[model samples]
Target: MMIDFMTLRADFPLLQQKNRGKPLVYLDSGATNQKPQSVIDAMNQYYISDNANIHRGVYELSERATYQYEKVRHDIKEFINAAHTEEIIFTAGTTAGINLVAQSYGRSKLKVLDEIIVSAMEHHSNIVPWQLLAEQVGANLRVVPITDNGEMDLEAYEKLFTARTKIVAIAHASNALGTINPLKQMIQIAHAHNVPVLVDGAQAFPHMPVDVQDLDCDFYTFSSHKAYGPTGVGVLYGKQKLLEKMPPYQGGGDMIESVTFARTTYSKLPFKFEAGTPNISGVIGFGAAIRYLQQVGMQNIAVHEAELLAYATQQLVTIPGLKIIGTAAEKVGVISFVLDGVHPHDIGTILDDHGIAVRAGHHCAMPVMERFNVPATVRASFGLYNTHADIDALVSGLKDVLRLFK
Candidate 1:
């Protein structure tokens, strides 16, 4: 069944709001998605009826809360097609998830002079953690260059892999360029070199179907907020063998089986990395978000987003002196473009006056912006609830801005 945009919009309260007597047009899902009522209600219901710290208490409320919290783990496992629930570890967000792997796996497995490969288009979250890990361990960070068309240089990437390459961490999709990387092929190449690959799925997860098993990536991370869930909750999915071999990411109450001044034994998989009290309600709300996506069907969502992107791109090209930053054959719904003689900040402010919200600036991808020789670009990203009308509104706003500037 085709997704009904009007019905979907009805589920999001923010879409109903008036901005300067105009309907709100949100085109910033790449930064963060607006929550649906189901997600909000799920969180509120949990807090109102089942608010309690999990795992330690014997009371009914605590037990129910613990069960609900753990249920999200199972939900995530199913969401990603992970082999086991134990492979799903909830963290603060994508940054925290990547850091957990770097501190645990990178510190233990990587040696001095070993190389970690990342792409030039990576977000700072993917780049900085590896940089810190390399600094700490005396490892080398190798960056794969991108084509002028904004896709990763896969040929160059293949040449960068060697016996010394211990890990390859790359984004599943370029948040700045909207270029979807060839992850399955990248995984195959990395595995041939016996290197484990970690994919930052923060952008891709929202727009496409991601099966870690199908991609065969060693590690996958994404933020719930990007997936229409609450903030402060994210997921890290790793192969059980790799996670078991890696050391614990943190030391705390739920992470330990027993503690002695002499020796401390850590808990098993998942918990060993999730040290403290997690975002219970946030995780539960994430489960609701996942459920919502499942009902909408990711395949349908992808098709809808692709149509919107093509429509937006076509109309955007009609505007005089506007150039899209990325022109990759494979892409998500994210459209980053620049207008001649206009700063992205000015474009963003002008659009805001029309009740159209879009992102401006480097998008936490300074290296990509530097590669393109631009300081920033205006980014408009689509979501499941978005329609062709939203793109029309954005194009109309852009035309007005162009007229004003000219």
Candidate 2:
């Protein structure tokens, strides 16, 4: 069944608002998606009915809240096809998830002189965490270069792998360039060297169907906000075996099996990593977001996004002074481009006047922009709710900008 975007758009209440006296055309789902009413209502219902601290209270509300919270873990486990619900750890966001791995897995497993590999197209969230870990542990950080076309240089990545490579951390999709990396092949290569690979799936998770078991990645991180869930909630999916071996990320109330001054033992699997009060309502909302995606179907979403990307690419190419940044064969629904003689900020402001929203800046992938030798580009990212008319509006907005600047 074909999903009607007009009907789908109605689910997101914010989409109905007017921007600058015109209907808003939101194209910035790459940064964070707009929430659906179902997700919002789910969160509100949790706060109203099941408001209590989880895993601690003995009351009925606490038990129900705990059940709902853990149910979201099961939902996430199924959403990513994780081997076990215990393998899913909820953190603040992708940033926190990566940091948890870096501090727990990287610090405990990595020795001095061990190497970690990352790609040139990684967001700062993926890069900085490893860098901090490397600096702290006296380890080395190796970078995989990218080609001129914004795709990861597979040959360069192969050359960087060595016996000392303990971990390979890279983004499944580049947030700045929108290039989908060859993650399956990359995982195969990493496993050949007996190294674990961590994928930052922040951008890819929203647009594609992800199976952690199929990919066989050691760890995968994604933000709920980017996937139409609430902020302050994200998921980290790790292989069960590796997660058992890793130490606790943070020491707090829930992560303890026994607590004493002489001997304090940590809990098993995911609970060890997730300490302190979690985002209970946000996780409930995340489940609703996943349900929303399931109802729409990921394959259907991917097709619609691909069509929008192709149409947007074609329309932008027709303009005289516009250039799309990433021209990779495999891409998501993002189109990053530079307009001649106009800064990306200027283009964004002018487009905002037309109620056409787009992101303008480095997109937290400064190394990518540096590699391309440009400061930043205007990024128009599509979501499941976006339609061909949104692309037309964006194209028309860009044309006006070009005419005004020319």
TM-score of each: 0.99, 0.99
Q: Give the per-residue lDDT digits (tens) of candidate 2, residues 1-406.
A: 7888668998999999999998999999999999999999999999888899999999999999999999989988998899899999999999999999999999998989999999999999999999999999899999999998899999889889888899999999999889999999999999999999999999999999999999999999999999999999999999999999888888998899999899999988778987888888999999999999999988888988998899989888998888899999999999999988999999999999999889999999899899988999999999999988999999889889988898
The per-residue C-alpha lDDT of model 2 at residue 70 equals 92
In angstroms, the error of model 2 at 205 is 0.5
Runs in model 1 deviating more than 4 A are none
lDDT of 1: 0.93
Tell me the alpha-carbon RMSD of every candidate.
0.9, 0.8
Candidate 1, residues 64-160, lDDT tens digits: the string is 9999999989988987899899999999999999999998999998899999999999999999999999999999999999999999898999999
Q: In candidate 2, how many Å is residue 140 off?
A: 1.4
Name the regions of candidate 2 deviating beyond 4 angstroms. none
lDDT of each: 0.93, 0.93
Q: Itemize residue pairs with steric clashes in candidate 2.
A: none
